[model samples]
Target: MMTNTQTSSSTERIAAEAPLIERLRAGDDGAFAELVSTHTGRMLVVARRVTGSEADAEDAVQEAFISAFKNIEQFDGRSTLGTWLHRIVVNAALMKRRRKRSRPETSIEQLLPQFDDGFHREKPQSIEVVTNGGGGSIVEREAVMAALDELPDEFREVIVLRDVEGLDSKSAAESLGISDSLVRQRLHRGRQALMKLLERRMKGIES
Candidate 1:
């Protein structure tokens, strides 16, 4: 929960950004530079989590910045600049991911949880999906990340956008050019696969 002071500070920050948004709309080069310098790190974090490749992430950020600059005029104050850019970055990263030759979706089925006649074959352990900079030891975090990369593109993209990037299902669906129901389905299965992979990875590390 946000305190009153935090709420007030947030309101003030948004108000302060009004002028910068206006300048950006007016084609102020300085404002554009300022926006890039200030928000590039945030955008890069989202891009990296989505693409899982430094080169791809860098390319996505570049594409996102270009899209942001070109579409600044359409940005209403309904959403914060950060929120807007976050969506742009997700879209850019998803596009880059699509351009790559992807593995078969069938490969991910083997990674998901197994069940028998509407019941688990074995009781599964609860495993948390750790997003970038989320709580966990460095080793656990790295293992979780590696597990994420091992997921097939179909499931991995949804998990990264919904869980890692913190986008809602509808937004993630739009970014992925899929339906909201598909986003939900993929996220559910993606999390299961991620946990199972992480469990094996941790066991390997322990041994």
Candidate 2:
């Protein structure tokens, strides 16, 4: 759920973007350039996460921008333009993934914490996947991305949408065509798997 302040800020941003959206709908080339320049990098990041390759991600972002341009008039003021574009990019990436044959994925169940008959972890270990980084270091960011990339597609998608992209459970569920309960379950298991991967990476780096 969005806080009052977040809702107000989003509303203000949408209001501010009204003129730009109008220009886009009017097919103003300069306005389109501005939109592309402002959002391409962020959109590429989302695409890369979803498609898992630079070339495919770039294609996905390009397709998303073209689609967004074609449908600019249909965009209601319910969400900011950036948010709308983000959704388009994600959809494009998902479509690209469906078109391409994906590599074999690792089983997330192997990474999840196992429990015995008493509901106790058979081999308990602390798993902490830092979603919000206190240290904004490039190395830390890369580490997080690396760990995220190791997860299976389903698990990775859930974590990226919820933890990295800041989507609520309901929103993520809607985006992925999954239930709210499944989103929560995937998020929990994904974070645990990610934490284990990150810890191993950090230890390897230290060694």
Candidate 3:
């Protein structure tokens, strides 16, 4: 019997790679369009999570596609094209951020976490509040998005990749060029951080 975790991991792995494998390998034009349609939104979301700016995310995604097309020949069927494209996008986004940080090296230090410890472990309390009608009708869906904006970029990126983009730990780790264990740790810590942020925001509102 497949454990729930194994089933989820298998399902995500299959979903993430199957389309690119089919369309790109077969040289099907419609497959390319299908690929774009299937991944563009989530790619943008991941890009935005990494770059922390929609404009940068847009640029990163465009550049990633360009890179992916150029590198398609290098793609072995060993991994999905979506995974390949995601790595390209992340590199592009990181390069853009590095360019932006050129003037102030301090920003790099500020952005990256100092330690691997899961310092931010608990999720924002807002989820409970939101579930319990704490905000009632006042907080719109956009507010939740904005709350995500409040998280540190790294935390947001891991969470968005794992929870929002629906990437498994392996693919997410591969995309980020990190270990799978690290991806799992980040995802756990990221969820905790977001939950903590939400809780704090909710308390502030009620007070």
Candidate 4:
């Protein structure tokens, strides 16, 4: 049986769609609540990937929601509502990155400490295959997450949108405010960096 919370959440989501579509056209209250509930989770993930910090991600999501609410009427409804919202979230995240980069802070290169060991880079073996073969332990998974965190913001955003969020290259590019070629370029570089990180970790296990 569905719990009261589940029922309420489901009902709210369902009720949101039609009302949201209408209210967005006319600019009404339901538009805001509807969008917030529907897109917040995915938007947060997008923001987190771009900003690489939980607090910054939360702020970016909030700003994105506010911007979307204000500009709802401009939405053409050609794409899924989620896609529009994802674009807004990406814009917000990129703005946050701009602000941070503009501030006087430690340069990313300066922040990195030298490593004493060498590691090889290779094509990434599939995580699913390795895990199913009982090759990945909890520590391995943590290392992968850590490597993702180390990626440059541009590389990280494309990776999250494409691989993690399952967005196509065109959609991901639209969301990131970049061209398809740039999206492909970023994804390629991002994958290479991730593969290098993973290979380094795997080498640790072998040694």
lDDT value, residue 46 of candidate 1 = 80
Mind giving the per-residue lDDT tens digits that candidate 1 earns over 1-207? 111222356456678789999999899999999999998888888888878888999999999999999998898766567767877898898789778747644376777777899798888654443332344588776886888878887898888878776678877786777999999999998888887788777656431
Superior by TM-score: candidate 2 or candidate 4: 2
Candidates in order have lDDT scores of 0.79, 0.81, 0.66, 0.70
Which candidate comes out best when scored by lDDT? Answer: 2
TM-score of structure candidate 3: 0.62
Task: Please give the range of 10 consecutive residues that has the lowest summed lDDT in model 4.
Answer: 1-10
Per-residue lDDT of candidate 4, residues 79-189 (tens digit): 556767778888888789778864343233422323445533333456555445546467666766767766767777788788876777888888877999999987887
Q: Give residue 164's error in model 2 in angstroms.
A: 2.0
TM-score of each: 0.77, 0.78, 0.62, 0.68
Candidates 3 and 4, the one with greater TM-score: 4
Model 2 whole-model lDDT (C-alpha atoms): 0.81
Q: How many residue pairs clash in each candidate?
A: 0, 0, 11, 0
Judging by TM-score, tell me the better candidate of 1 and 3.
1
The superposed Cα distance between candidate 1 and the true structure at residue 171, in angstroms, equals 4.9
Q: Which portions of model 3 miss their true places by more than 4 Å? A: 1-38, 97-127, 134-143, 205-207
Model 4: residues >4 Å from true position, as ranges? Answer: 1-19, 101-138, 204-207
Q: Per-residue lDDT for 67 in model 1?
A: 95
